[model samples]
Target: MCGMLGGLLLSAVLIEGKIYFSETFGEGWQQRWRLSTWKEGHAEKMGKWQTSAGKWYRDEVEDAGLQTAEIMKFYAISASFEPFSNEGKELIVQYQAKYEKDLACGGGYLKLGPSTEDLSKFGDSTKYNIMFGPDQCNAEKRTHLIFRYGGRNFLKKAELPYKQEGEGLSHLYTLHLKPDNTVRVLVDLDKIYEGSLKDDWEMLPPREIADPKDQKPSDWLDEEMMEDPADVKPPDWVESKMMVDPKAGKPEEWDDEEDGEWDAPKIENPNFKGPWLPRKIPNPDYKGTWKARIVPNPDFSDDPDLYKYSDIGYVGFDVWQVKGGTIFDNIIITDSLKEAEDMAQKWKALREVEDAAKKNEDEAQAKAFEKAKAARAARSKENKAGDTKNEKKDEL
Candidate 1:
């Protein structure tokens, strides 16, 4: 079994594919990556990226990747590569990421865009061909795979499912856009979704739309039900909820000249009916709710190259993290599925070590918590005894 698995790994590594841009965040990474100056003028509001393997990892130096170093700040950075166009080729983007702390609200996504002179000016508004990654805030968990067409970014209409991989542990994301306009997303080696681009996103104009000149007729009876014309109030029906008691007598101490006249107390009328509502019956003349006429959209056009990005020269992370500790590494923009899988194998080996470390840390935290709890209980007991001793002295 071991020999067979090794052969498979060898085959994956040997599969031919083109790698456009890749980064492992090795030494001198600061020279390759440029941080944005969008928030530089502000006082201490900008977040910076640094290399790390975090508190626990498989190999400190080997696992080191660019991590957001500051808390409660925004981070923007990008690395440029030789400009290339994936007009007729398969495109695959893969990355390894870890939200070491406060994954409560932030994105671990990256974008591919064209090269620019001022990397310092790169910010959230920077236009890009594709934006793919994991984003989370509060209860929403999304794997964003957006395609930009005609200056508008379109997200997949169907939600891509996502799950958390615990704190301090790394996760892998792989997005593949095929030459056939099909796409697939994988998280931690698990295939999450696979479908066509045109079916999943609104990149082209809709086939049909509501007619602008059409209107519902004024005489249309849209109501499905109406009050029954035959239904009427019965002559014996009582409207009063409560009534004066007819059998009660005035008090014996009552004085007619000095006191006001005595009145009987009220009691719920047994014959009373609750607020009356007319019985509903189906309207014979009812036409269902009116709708405008549908017509073909004038702007409707289809393109076969929705999956293509004309130019991809830069890979960047433009993100705002309230409490940042997200580490992004092993980024690859390639054209081979096998190449991406081989990288995934690398992450698998690293994750096994990280998971074991996370388990040990969690257990240690639990044990420390128990010890603190016992000490607090002992102190409370001593305080109660001291209060009792003082009470006895006061009694003397």
Candidate 2:
């Protein structure tokens, strides 16, 4: 009995230890990414890494622009496992991350596996994202949450301040996977924005394969993974059909002309004022008083004036940190999209007013120029007349 039990335990351990794929920043492996490069079209920079005590470490820095709340977040991320293994089992994963002290406008996270489909019921759902950044200020100075779901992708999501009293560091996020394929995320460090859906969470079922028995294929596996033998009897018409050739690349007689290729238009950041930071979502269901905290970055000696309008073309900065303060925890549950639109509309109106003022100034300048030209013409005419009269008098 003891021998049998030991053998069973060994089998279980072997199965558990089997890794489909993995790449830790171990001895020789080095993977680093800049926190700033997450901007839509920010160009990627060369990565830097060092070896210490037989271990390898890489650091990624992003030039996320010079504006405050322009969160520059990067992660040394990796993904492994046989995606097409046809196994219907879900995975539970965990990892550790560390952030530098006074690392204003930054945070890190470990992302798990992702599906390649639009999981959000709304046709516009993203697949993966991670959050990071400084945790200060209310509704303005914010940390970051980055995600890429559906086809559209965005970076540096602004975090709302929900903490009130003490200073805290180090965050742990856990994912709970249910047998029903539902996944939930829990943030351990700060409970500001909790229980938010990271993606559409694709939970739809497949429709291809029919039954597992009678030579029928499983729905989990793709068509190309199925195999058939020529000599053997062709099974039922449904299951006997030859599967797509997985080894095939592009068709041999492919014609580029038939399918014209066009480059996607690249988007660049507008040369606008500083504080071009992400939008913040405010909680509206608060019951008591709330305070805003000013998160300081000691490394930066430049006064907040650097981001003032006189310096960057606009008056007030887009995102600003609190000099010294803290916000007490208050439950304000509300939607963010509506709030962001309201804020944007206000900005739009202000811009319109500025534009109208500028137009009026231009018109006034033009009118003055016209008046000066008219006066000069009248003077010239009078001088010419006087000279004609004098000539006439001399002739007489």
Which one is best on TM-score?
Answer: 1
- Number of the predicted model whose lDDT against the real structure is largest: 1
Model 2: what TM-score?
A: 0.26
TM-scores for candidates 1 onward, in order = 0.79, 0.26
Query: 296 in model 1: Cα distance from truth in Å?
Result: 3.5
Clashes of 1: 0
Question: What lDDT score is found at residue 213 in candidate 1?
Answer: 92
How would you encode candidate 1's per-residue C-alpha lDDT over 1-396 as one tens digit per residue? 213223322322324678888888998889899988877577387787888998877789989999998887888899899888888777888899898885678888898887777788788888888888888887888888898988889999987876545888888887777777888777776778888988889888888999999988988999999999899988888889999987777889998788887778988899999777779999998999889999999999988988877778899998878788899989888886666666777688888888898889889999999999999999999999999999999999
TM-score of predicted structure 1: 0.79
Q: What stretches of model 2 exceed 4 Å from their correct place?
A: 1-24, 31-87, 112-171, 184-396
Summed over model 2, clashes come to 17
